[model samples]
Target: MQKYPMTKEGEQALRDELQQLKSVERPKVIEAIAEAREHGDLKENAEYHAAREQQGFIEGRIQDIEGKLSNAQVIDITSIPHTGKVLFGTTVSIINCDTDEEVQYKIVGDDEADIKNNRISISSPIARALIGKEEGDIVVVQVPAGAVEYEIDQVQHV
Candidate 1:
């Protein structure tokens, strides 16, 4: 399997989630299964079936998180030198050339990308367009709606 780039925060978040699943969720499911078993008649036991299904989902998620954590290359943005160029883990402020509206986004790994939080994946069209570009540079990105132009106003490593 190929390794993927991830922010340090993203890696830690995944680890924390995995820990919760294993330490808290797994034990809760086990107890639920035990309680269901005591009721007898497993063939028609709805609680038992539901508990088993939930266990399967929790286990699958735990494995997925473990795999992602193992393959992650955590990048610490704070350690890098700020050169005013758009790079991974850099927070970029941009102005829509047409509307002159300002938008800020933090370029992060795929796992950490949340539009509501203003965090974008490095693989996203906007981030791809901004990568390697410096502040005051204008970039045109091809989006599903059409091509959009943005001017890089500032770049900060946080």
Candidate 2:
């Protein structure tokens, strides 16, 4: 089984979602299906069909989260001493060499990557280039828009 590298927060988020799906969504769907069954005519029961479909989705997601958690290698970055080097779950500050714009991104697992929240996947090109590099290092990343150079300004465990 491939181990999924994730931060403590990422693991907690997945566990929380799994709990919600199991305790809340699963029971709600089961109740809905039971209520729909009382309406009779299983052949033309749209509510029943929709409820069953939703139950399937919730169960699938629960299983997926369980599998991920079982294979997850949760990393508590705060437990490690900061070395000013970029690693998985570390927040990085990079300055654009071309536009002189600065941006901060927290390198996280694929499931936790949200660009809007400044979280980037470890497999992304920029994150790949940033990994193993230290502060003050200039790294070039090849994106769809072409090659972009970014100077590593800071690396934080938080």
Candidate 3:
């Protein structure tokens, strides 16, 4: 019963996926299995085996999504008043102290993290260092290359 912290959009995405799996994918897999069964010999039916494997994967995903949704603690960042402090569901703008490169990242739940999209997981090293820090704070993150210093420039709720 571990609670999962996620933004409202993240929770909705997971719910949408669960709905698709149960309503569309589950039925399609069941239909495929039935069709494969009509072919007769169960011992030598490749279609049947493939359908079964697909069904297993679909069912597992459905269960996983359901579990996460049930334990989700959805946070609406827009509804919360911004205090200039870095927090979950907040978008943070940081500047590299050494390289002077500026970047923005939205702190999100583990399942919704996409580095390419500028969304980072709360458990990540940089996010961990940024959490609870206020704008204008300088934080150091340990990367594979070495320790990098970043200055927090802005914190946005949107």
Candidate 4:
């Protein structure tokens, strides 16, 4: 199996989710299942069916988290030496060459990419364009909206 890159923070987030699933959700679902079972006939019970479905979902999520964690290659961004260039886990500040709009994004693993949080996947077109480029370098990214040019303003490993 291929190993997947993940930031330390991402790995911890997955571990926390797994812990919550195993310690909290699993027990709660078991309790719910037991309570539903006490309501009598398992064949026609809607509560029992709902609880069983929820249990299945929880178990599936738990397994998925476990698998990802096992395959994770946790990278500590803070420990990486600053090279004044874009790399995985590097927070980059860029200026839109056309619009003059500045935006900051952290290049992270696929699982940790959250657009709302300004975390982009390393495999993303913009990140791919930014990688290995130093400050003041201009990169053209191909997006669904078309090609956009951005100037690298800063790169920080934080």
Alpha-carbon local distance difference test for all models:
0.95, 0.95, 0.95, 0.94
Assess candidate 3 and give its TM-score to the true structure: 0.97
Backbone clashes in model 1, listed as residue pairs: none
Count: clashes, candidate 1:
0
Model 2, range 1-158, lDDT digits (tens) per residue?
79989899999999999999989999999999999999999889999999999999999999899999999999999888888899999999999999999999999999999999999999999999999999999999998989999999999888
lDDT of 4 at 134: 97
Per-residue C-alpha lDDT of model 4 across residues 1-158, encoded as one tens digit per residue = 88889999999899899999999999999999999999999999999999999999999999999899888888987888888989999999999999999999999999999999999998899999999999999999999999999999999988
The parts of candidate 1 lying over 4 Å away from their true place are none
Question: Candidate 4: lDDT of 151?
Answer: 97
Better of 2 and 3 by TM-score: 2
Task: List model 3 lDDT by residue over 1-158, tens digit each.
Answer: 68989999999899899999999999999999999999999899999999999999999999999888888889899888889899999999999999999999999999999999999999999999999999999999999999999999999988
Task: Estimate, for each residue in 37-149, the C-alpha lDDT of model 1 and write its tens digit.
Answer: 99999999999999999999999999999888888989998898888899999999999999999999999999899999999999999999999999999999999999999
RMSD of each: 0.7, 0.7, 0.9, 0.8
Per-model TM-score on C-alpha atoms: 0.98, 0.98, 0.97, 0.97
Given candidate 3, what's the lDDT at residue 5? 91
The best candidate in terms of lDDT: 3
